[model samples]
Target: MRRLADASAPERRKWYARGAFFHAEDLHYLKFLIGEGARVLELGCGTGELLAALRPRYGVGVDFSAGMIGEAHKAHPHLTFLVGDIEDEAFIRQLPGPFDVILVVDTLGAVDDCQGMFENLHALCARETRLIVGYFSHLWYPALKAAETLGLKMPQPAQNILSPADVGSLVALADFEAVKSERRLLLPARVFGLGRLFNRFIAPLPLVSSLCLRHYTVCRSLRHRSADVRSASIVVPARNERGNIEPAVQRIPRFVEDLEIVFVEGHSQDGTWAEIERVRAVYPHYDIKAVKQPGKGKSDAVFAGFEVARGDVLIILDADLTVPPEQMPKFWEAIRSGKGEFVNGSRLVYPLEVQAMRFLNLIANKIFSILFTWLLSQRFTDTLCGSKALRRSDYARLKAARGYFGEFDPFGDFELIFGASKLGLKAVEIPIRYASRTYGQTQISRFRHGVMLLRMVVFAFLRIKAM
Candidate 1:
């Protein structure tokens, strides 16, 4: 295997240039999976082309073959290249790293001990690091062999043909959790722009997606965490819930000693802002803060509150008090214990209170839940639940990357949901009993919001799946 790799080192650029279109597609998906300016480490990085294309702030490429490392250094002098066996425990442990993203593209199948390689990779990962593995689908083995025989691709030594399921199992065996997995690239070569159309539209469809050529799985180390207790910030986006202001604070369980509650009133006419101020004054013992949102929707209000929040963990609490404040502790514990990086409240699990949700709304929530489960590759029982928790640092990362989706969400639910999915945060849902509002009418319009949701579904498809 080493001899074959060494012999092909001289022609590496030639082969990649011949298949420029195919390679470009792979790079497109990789760029989407990895953010720019991250600390990156790539194993079996042949010629370092992919690593250089990623534009990492600090980039390192390692390969077992000296010829490949030499070529990589000559081609991309900005990146560090080293010739070392990835399966060697001593060699892998000596590297300096806690990289933000690690790439193992098509390298696992060539290694003798895949599980050992994955275990060694844990040394290079922090809690937020993501391990991305991209490989060719075993179903395309015959086509790849034919291309190699025809001199259209680089020749390779005999290697294992692993499926997505196989890779997922190996990840689990190495104590890593598989967060997301998918297949793409229906057409490897671009033929008069039809390849782009088919790959973008028809290739990602349900049954059709399974037949694609490329497979990618993203995993994160499960054992990486800190045991320190984190502070908490709960932002309540209030509209007209004047009567529920004081009770919202009082009902909250003492989840943590260092906690701050922020109330963002959104141009309510029912004296909600005055009620928030009164509650702040009355609760001298509790740390309460009130602020009027500069904008109209719940999304704006929540973000406004987040801007001023000073806590290790940030949570959203609906001012309507439908999802009881008592449930806040569950979210806090879920995040603090490292059970999940993002904790979402699920109202669909337990029985609903009288008039908690209307018939149509319940049906819509179920349908959206299914759609989001498919779209995000993470199961979501309730997508629009206003109660959620995530570390403030994760929120800052998500907020920085928010420009990709733009300001599309008005209810504030999809903003966090989409952001969490993009950041590869481990999502865990906590079951909570749903209750009807006691003070004010619901701020939702069934038909109008339903139409808007349909639009969001289409928008998400274009932004997430089609891309």
Candidate 2:
């Protein structure tokens, strides 16, 4: 602490101006983590390069050195600045309230007390907070030493050499989950064509990108949420098929532990709501609620039902019964096994009931599956057969990040798929038998819905693949 106090302000300023190793680091980080209009707090924002790159409308930069804070203020005049130790609870207390994205670039490695820093940062985040942390990898310590010796990168102090697991442990101790952790380089694309090649070939592949230059960690804030394992939301959006309600509920496999049924009666000319109420009366033992959709379509109806749902796991079950209730246990098993954050039902793999899908539908499903697999770098065997499962915690993250895709999706498939892709969640598909809908006429307008699907595909290309 004495040596740090005696360190000349001009020395720190010179070091910052030189911009060693991490000059362009924030550009990628801002593109990947901190999107526009987000409220962001940056710890140890020396020279404020990342702060300026993110262009946060509500940005706050913190640093311990008065010189660093001055330089940050000069470099990024728009952002608010507070010169204080990140570990100081009283200092964090004096600042403003919670932020959406809190960054700690190159802060943890230098902190004298890493545990204190983690505890304090946990206090600054809400349940939906995202923290992007990166530091030079200790695995590359030899290369760094070699580079410094060769005078490529400057070296002076004995910086703390830590592993990715060390940082992740600290994050977990802070009560946040490490959603994504990766290693990226300071190397330029032009100079290293092979590096760029890896980005195209191997990096986009699921599960391989985690080990690439410096250690990068993306953490989600913690909430003491209880999984009302029994309070299940079964959403069945039905249309002209008025006869399916009672059978759907009765046939819906009792896979979940605690269950409640919410029937989203969407624009059905048939007495779907009346039938739902009839079913509720018949099965007084079941927790059943019927809501006639004020909206027009399945996507809108699903969103509406979700708004009124009070459950831990929100499930989408098509009224057509293409996916039987008995198969839901497979989804539960996939989720419980921690195979994926989102468990999508794949009808293409298993044998479907004869006449399950028309020839064109099967072809379209296969084509879109290939395209999305290529685009999001995640495999999906079927995209249109509307059955998806995820936790409410994940749904909250999607809601918070809705601006990323806006309200353009009408099918509801893009919402979860795109959200999970961007959030770096492991999306797994479970094979299920597709039973042809027994009760209702199909509501999907082939041409109109196909066009919407095409629009979503293009939108997803830009949002997930191109970006």
Candidate 3:
């Protein structure tokens, strides 16, 4: 296989060009998964196209074919490319450690020992690092073989035909957890633009997704946390919730050693700003900060609070106090213990308090949860929950890459949820006993928000599922 690849290296660019549409779609999904200026490493990098396209702060490509590495160096001199067999333990040991994202795109089939290759990657990952392994789905074997015979696709050496289950099993054997798995690109050719429609819409549908030509499995290291104690910043977005101000602060337990509370007032007419000031003064012993949002929506308020926040972890705690502050420890522990990267509150898990949620709202939450679960390729029990938690570093990365989704989210929940999904952060739900608001009327206009949510569903479909 090495000799074959080395012999074919010079013609690799022509082969990829012949399949331009498919190659471009593959790169598009990769760019969506990986943020620009990340530290990236790619194995089996043919001509280094995938690595260079990522525009990483530090990019490295490794391939067994010397010819491929030569072409890669000539094309992308900025990136580091090496000619070495990834299957060799000694060769793997010499490479750098701790890349932000590691990619094995379309090359896993040639691997002789998949489990050993994955095990070797352990040293190349940090606790937060994500490993993406993309390959042709086993179901596409017949179609790919026919394409190769018909000269429509690049000919290949004999390789392993692995299913998602096979990849998941290998990942577990290597002591890594598969966070999410997705099937994509049903039609590999542009047949009068019908391929785009099939790939963007029909391909993502429930049963039809099984027919996708490519599959991606996202994995994360299960290593222990580097530090035992981490600080937290809980951002409370208050809007006309004056009566719940002090209680919100008072109920919060100091779960972490260092905790800071930030209250962002969103132009509330009911003296919410005055109440925030009062709470800041009253909670002198507690680290508290208050700020007025420059814009109107909750998303704006959350971002404003994030700017002033100074903690290792950032959390969104609603000022309405529906999701009790006492349940915050679960979120902190989830991140601290490496259980999940993005912690979301799930009000639908445990029984809600009487009058806590309306029937229509409850039905909508369930429907959106299913939709998001499918859209993200990660299970989400509740999508509209106001409380969410993530590391400040992860939040920084998400904020930097927010342009892909834009500022389309008004309620602030979907923004974080979407960003977390795009960044490949493991989403975990902590069941919370949602309670009825005690002090303020509900600010959400059901019909207006419903229409907006429908629009967001379409937006997410385009940005997420359709790529």
Candidate 4:
């Protein structure tokens, strides 16, 4: 308690943000913390430098140091700055919250007890909130000790080093699951230009270079506290399948407490939107909406619908009815139970309905799934099933990771699948009954879609499997 109280005293934190390179790395870490427009509360924010760097929609920085709080306020007037102890629940609760991210940087070493500190921070966040924790790595102790002796590193003793395993175990006890971890550097200022180039191209590669100096972990709360959880938004893209919209909605057994059906009318020349709007009137009691496609294809329609979805969980439901809507619970339950971060409905495993898939399509699916699974070491039975569920938060993260893959996919499957792989998400497939589309026509030109799918498989193999 004394350590927590004194660690961030005004006098101690005044000198915290003097280094430019260190500040840049801290900003880089913040980019990983939250999506743009996310709410944030940074606990034990010394000089509130990190809070200032992140610039979230609602940024709040709390510190024990009155000096740090004052400095934080001056630098980021838009953010609410408070003087408080993170270890004190009453104090923590006083600060406004329900933040999307709870950030703690470099303060972990100062806390008297990591477990107690994490518990309090976890209580201040939303269920979908992510915890971004970063610390000086234990392996760097020798180098830091030497640097401190020569006045190169921060002047502090032994700095309460915790191993990666210890940190993981503590996070679990705090009821927050660790999703990812990695090392990054705060390059010295002497070679600023060269350092930028290294980080941009060279340093990110696994083979070349320095690690074990810094560690960052991305975490999610295991417990949820929302009083009234929002309904899952299910986005369905209908093309020529005008006949199937009614059954899809009718058979969509409401697994979630609240549900909204978003139908993206993919420029179907066969009056798919007309049928959708007709079905909409029938379900006026149910929350349903019809959105015209922003672009011509199913992928474009899905992306457009995802843009406006307002739900705790976002789901993609195929308009073809190939995967039954009743089985949606499987995907939802999988994510809720933490069985996997992504739950994809699989039709290849089951004896798909007679004439459901042409032999060529079946073979293509099997071949593509095998290549992707083998390449990523992530199992995938059916690649084209078109039913997947994840929270809106998860989807945002995937979109950010999409920078690694480029906008290479026209179908949007690779975008999600590859992001899940890169983020280290557990990708599991759920078998479902595949029913043939009862509609105007099949929009897929198998040869073209197959070629695209093959290209994606190869690309994923190089990016994820190689990594």
Residue-by-residue lDDT tens digits, candidate 3, 1-467: 77888899999999989999998888888888888898999999989988998999999999989999999999999999999888888888888968999899887888889999988888888877899999988888988898999998889977799988899999989888898999999998899999888888888889998989989999987753342447999999999999999998889999987999999999999999998888788779999999999998888999999999998888899999999999999989988887889999999988888999999999999999999998888989999999999988889988987887777678888888889998888889999999998998988888888888888888999999986
| lDDT for residue 191 in candidate 2, whole number 0-100 | 47
RMSD of each: 1.1, 6.1, 1.7, 5.7
lDDT of 3: 0.89
Residue 126, candidate 2: how far off, in angstroms?
A: 9.2
lDDT string, candidate 1, 1-467, tens digits: 89888988999999999999888989988888788999999999999999999999999999998889999999999999999999998998899799999899989779999998999988998989999999989999999999999988888877788999999999999999999997889998988888888888888899999999999998999878542456899999999999999999899887899999999999999999999899888989988888999988889999999999998889999999999999898898888988888889999999999899999999999999999998888899999898998999899999988878767677878878888988888899999999988889888888887888778888888777888
Regions of candidate 1 where Cα sits further than 4 Å from its true position = 226-229
Assess candidate 3 and give its TM-score to the true structure: 0.96
Which candidate's TM-score is highest? 1
Instruction: Point to the candidate with the largest lDDT.
Output: 1
Lowest summed lDDT window (length 10), candidate 3: 221-230
Assess candidate 4 and give its TM-score to the true structure. Answer: 0.72
Displacement of the residue 18 alpha carbon in candidate 3, Å: 2.0
TM-score of each: 0.98, 0.67, 0.96, 0.72
Stretches of candidate 3 off by over 4 Å are 224-229
lDDT of 4 by residue, 1-467 (tens): 34533554454444454456666755764574455677888877766667766768888888777766776677668888888778887887777777778887777877888898888775577655778787876867787778768855456634678766678888999887777665556353438477655554454345442453566677777675232335688899888888888888898878877888889987787888899989888888878888988777677888788887887677899888778888887877777666667778888877877789999999988888887665554578887878988777778878777788777577788788877755556567788888876665677899987888778866764554322
lDDT of 3 at 130: 91
Which segments of candidate 2 are over 4 A away from where they belong? 1-25, 28-32, 35-230, 255-258, 329-340, 377-379, 423-426
